[model samples]
Target: MERHATSAELKARAKGQLLGKYGTIIPAILIVEIIMFAITSVITLPLDTQTMPGLIISFIIECLLQLFAGIFIAGQTYLYLNISCGGNIRVSDVFYGFTHHPDKAILIQLYQLLLMLASFVPLFLLLALWMVIDSLYMLIPITIAFCFGLVASVIISLMYSQSYFVMLDFPDFSAVQCLRFSRKIMKGSKARRFYLDVSFIPLYLLGFLTCCIGLLFVIPYMNTTYSNFYLELMSKRNGGNVQ
Candidate 1:
């Protein structure tokens, strides 16, 4: 089996693509953050969050926000993909998901969310049992369940990390098909993906050291690199021919 590009190579490609583009990328990232902040602020303004009903409404709102965020993320992915490929892209392109097959985007996100929840079901069940039995022995099983759930959730997430990219590449495919294809291509490559992610920790830490202002730059660089990773993975799978 062939290996993908090293993390340094991918990041270098991302950096090269990002050169002179911060003028567009930074503002786009800010727009996304502002929009999310404004939506949360406006929606929760009238509600007394301390009350039970208000709390429930808040939870529902959070869930809806997550659903909407999925679409936004697809749009972001589209923008990054274009940037990485040197295609024409506008800051407004960040909203592409809303106009382009939003249903599929939402469905993909919902499916992933459900899978994550399902992964934790065992942990939930064991915790519930421990609550009822009130035995010290139950702690061992609960701990084991928690560990298993965490590992499963992480695996599932990594497996489907490329779903949005797949969706963009194959617009005709259904959400489930996109997910299945992502998992297929991701086989034996999750560690590569995970390592690539870990490699960004220093940049994230640097962003934090800058009072988060640097994250505006880091976010797009990281996203574009991940986009490159997806492209490289696809290129490898297709005999070095990236569509």
Candidate 2:
């Protein structure tokens, strides 16, 4: 039998998980992410110029930075998920997540980077054609492109949502297998996942409203909460305890 959780139950689980682990891990994760972003910005700065060469260089540098950041973020999520299970949460757990499963973590990161690039190709081509056409006729293809692009984005989100956990918990599984497993878990549960995504909208808005300072709290809160939600869902499906 398939198992399910209501939005309220998920939210409660998230809250409990966040409160339980916030003091031990959130600060470390935030610091690591901030440092990674800063380093990425510094490495890619020269590539952001207006020239063609600069643009090309910037694109390449940006892609590399995203790959690096994805690894760090995915590793952090893995550590957090393990903690959400039975393991003790520690600052070092984040580092261990990378060291212990370096290859899988990097592969997962690469997969994410590729998906991001793939998602933009169509939109990029559509816009390029629009610039060339520069007319009402361009709107037709652009609109169609936009709809397909939106659907693709959602599908990608659903497919890869649980990838970090898969990499962490099921190290033997390949990236494609992990992605397929995530999609299967999400199947017949689109409405719940959509609601979960929607629930984060207010947090994002709050962050925006606060000049992004709110993110310091909101990001950790959301990450921890979502980790718990993922654990609960998996536990129910496998008929196992959360620990």
Candidate 3:
């Protein structure tokens, strides 16, 4: 494995790649997102979400949307990384996941969503118990339990953070297999990943400061930085033989 990129390097590389291309990348991303959202709504149409049938339908639709989202996310990630590494690129590169193994893209997302939900069981149980408890003082401990559950869920998430990209790298892998591989590769990078995530706070605030419009630029930069970090880590995992 080679030396991993510093946070600064990853972000700077993201910005550099997008320097003259924000117009294309941003609109392409937005188009993908809008289509995904519309399809999601269509799939779960006209259901009153307050009802049980509605809830179940919503859950199924949510899972399905995960599939669409995974494809777009992976596609965009490929585009950004390709351009950053000096490949000739096009906006339609955003559809690579779908044009390739769309099923795998969707399945990985469904699997990960289930895994994420499973991680929240403790939180759900605590909240349910908290709702039934009699005394006000008991609420304090319940609150603490909820907080603990939340922190645990976040840790669980970081463990699987790289799974989708791993799917891209190893298309033959089953969803569970990619998750296991992600956990293996991410062993010592959790804290560093956390720091990388934290370093985006100011950029997020700056976007917010611009009345949400600044997000047109900030979000794309954020996505590319994330892609760079993943590529850097992947390269290190492959002993500097990043393909």
Candidate 4:
């Protein structure tokens, strides 16, 4: 029988998992992500003198590199989390996440990207309209963009709150099915998820304030906790049984 955990219990169990199994890998993941970011920055540097064609080429190359790196890093992180939690993982397990479930992972990534991009479209359009209507009022676009971006970010996070879990736990599920399952699992709990996300805001700000060193701890904590949360949910759905 599945064991249903209250949110508080879920959070506590996740914390325990983080402390026990995945704590050591936190620093390594941070180093890897930082190295990736650095490489991306170096490759995307603007030339001192930017001709239009040169600038365009550089921009495209930079964007492509960034996209590739982002996907690879994210996939690797998921793999690492799964393995670290005792799933018999390896270094190459990162690539395996995508390779093993190419369609579903790709779809998830694409959907996430589209949602992010779509969220900005309206703000951008409003900004353009504002520019045309009142060029002197540049603040309008800035404010609107900031507000819309904030709201959109929250929505996107909620929508994909269970994406990693879906990827790990429901490999047999199609992309659309995984998305739908995430929605169903999170149903009637958008506000609760939002609140959970909000609770992390302070840690995020603290990491920023500390020049990201704090992420060495925060990232691992969040990932492991999230994995544990997934386990808890799965256990509940599967009749209080966890493997």
Any residue pairs clashing in model 3, and if so which?
A: none
lDDT of each: 0.92, 0.72, 0.77, 0.65
Using Cα atoms with residue i matched to residue i, what is each candidate's TM-score against the true structure?
A: 0.91, 0.86, 0.84, 0.73
Q: Please give, for residues 1-243, the per-residue lDDT of candidate 2 as tens digits.
A: 656777777667656666666676667767787788788778876564788788888878777776666567665786667655656767766675557656666667677667766876887898988888788877877888778877777777766788877766677898778777877776666667777778889889989899887877677667766677678667877787753
Name the candidate that leads on lDDT.
1
**Candidate 2 has which clashing residue pairs, if any?**
none
Candidate 3 lDDT over residue span 1-243, tens digit each = 546788889888998887888767777777886897688767777878999788988887787677678888778767776766767777898999878777777776777677667766766676667678766786676677677767766777778778767877787898788888888878998887889878888878988999867778887787778777778887886777777
The reply for model 1, stretches above 4 Å from the true place, is 44-58, 130-139
Query: By TM-score, how accurate is candidate 4?
Result: 0.73
Candidate 2 local lDDT, residue 32: 86
**Model 3: worst 10 consecutive residues (lDDT sum):** 119-128
When summed lDDT is taken over every stretch of 10 residues in candidate 2, the lowest stretch is: 96-105
